[model samples]
Target: CLSSQHTEGNVGTKSEEKLIELIPLIISCSREKHIWKHIYVFLTPGLKWHSAGVVRPTLTVLPPSKEEDKQSSATVVCLATGGFPSNWKLGWTVGGTSTSSGVSTSLEVLGTDGRYSWSSTLSLSADQWRKAGSVSCEASLSGQSPVTQTLDPDHCSE
Candidate 1:
């Protein structure tokens, strides 16, 4: 996880505003002789105001209860919060086989701080889930191991 954070430095009073003409930053305030102020500037090159953090994903199998031993469809929805400046890939895995047609992914929505919150859903037939196979939602990012969560059809229906 690559995160950029800046902390406020101790500034003493009796200081005057200093600006390099070559730089593009604009300071609107002047420091008094007896006052001190600390400022923290946060910015990311590819991502804005990013915090280095890993996302812990939550899984919801909708139509929560379903019929058993029958062919039906259910939704495997995953919601992840608090991931930074990275793209995520979500897929549907049935009995450890990845299904491309059964998966549909969504774009990342901008968060309050300009970070991203993402959601992806996979709809599969009931038989695939009921076969005692594993249905998983995996959130993939660069340089980090993907976070995967599994749902059990039998246990989910009960």
Candidate 2:
């Protein structure tokens, strides 16, 4: 069993005396049919608790990537040209928030073979784009974290 004890000043320590507890199971191997079944084992342990305070989780925001930091300002525009067959929703995030207004989404275009494509655009003046925290073209699939491409001021206007 795995166990730990914590003290006010120290992080929890694992119990070394009984570090392992084993559970056994009967198993059969196709390649070793003559052996019939072999014994399989696993270890599980009980955890101990202590009074030492736990560290609080700190919120961490990743800095915009180096490339993105440059794409700011100038006539800002966002585009999603393809990948519609996957039902990817395209949108923007500015100053760490999702934005729907000040944007225009296009109608889906269907290809001859049942595939589709779509585009969305978010525009801003050069000055506003420079000072804004971030400009992101986010593509999200249902029930999944969005994959975003951040446009940095350096990549923009220039």
Candidate 3:
């Protein structure tokens, strides 16, 4: 028992019966008002619709925790947040050389605002971290230019 109404407005609402049925579920949540506000905002017109697909992400390099052992390795994490489409490539390079060892990437997490966040980590030995040249993390998607963040390995000195 479902029905959809087509209006000139940019947003639409579910049938009254469906909303009544959803009341119980909404009441159990703390964000009921917030959810309803979004519904209302969606149903009304006169608002500009911005496409999230072209939104560029903000990139960050999380500071790595220091390791006391010279033989031990440290993890460098790069995070890209607030992007759309949920498909992005993350690659690691050390001194202009592509290195795939000790790398881990997480699946993109979709946010409530329709954007996404992704993260990748690379492990580097203490010697490599202290003596290596440039380390870069690149994030890319089809049809869009890639975004890169570079870090100096020498800056990781203990």
Query: Lowest-lDDT window of 10 residues in candidate 2?
Result: 51-60
> How would you encode candidate 2's per-residue C-alpha lDDT over 35-100 as one tens digit per residue?
443222222244442111111111111233335445642333444443423356667787688878
* lDDT scores in order: 0.53, 0.48, 0.64
lDDT of 1 by residue, 20-134 (tens): 1111122324445433322222342343332234354434434324442344766677776656543666666767877776666778765555355777777666666568467
| Per-model TM values vs. the true structure | 0.57, 0.45, 0.65
The TM-score-based order of candidates, best leading, equals: 3, 1, 2
lDDT string, candidate 3, 1-158, tens digits: 11133233453344432321111111112354442211111211222323332566888876467643344776789999987556777889888898899899999876656567999998888667666587888888887898888888667544
Clashes of 1: 1
The C-alpha RMSD in Å for every predicted model, in order, reads 12.0, 20.0, 12.0
Model 3: what TM-score?
0.65
Q: Model 3, 111: alpha-carbon shift in Å?
A: 1.2
Pairs of residues at least 3 apart in sequence or in different chains that clash in candidate 1: 14-33
> Which one wins on TM-score?
3
Q: Please tell me which model should have the higher TM-score, number 1 or number 2.
A: 1
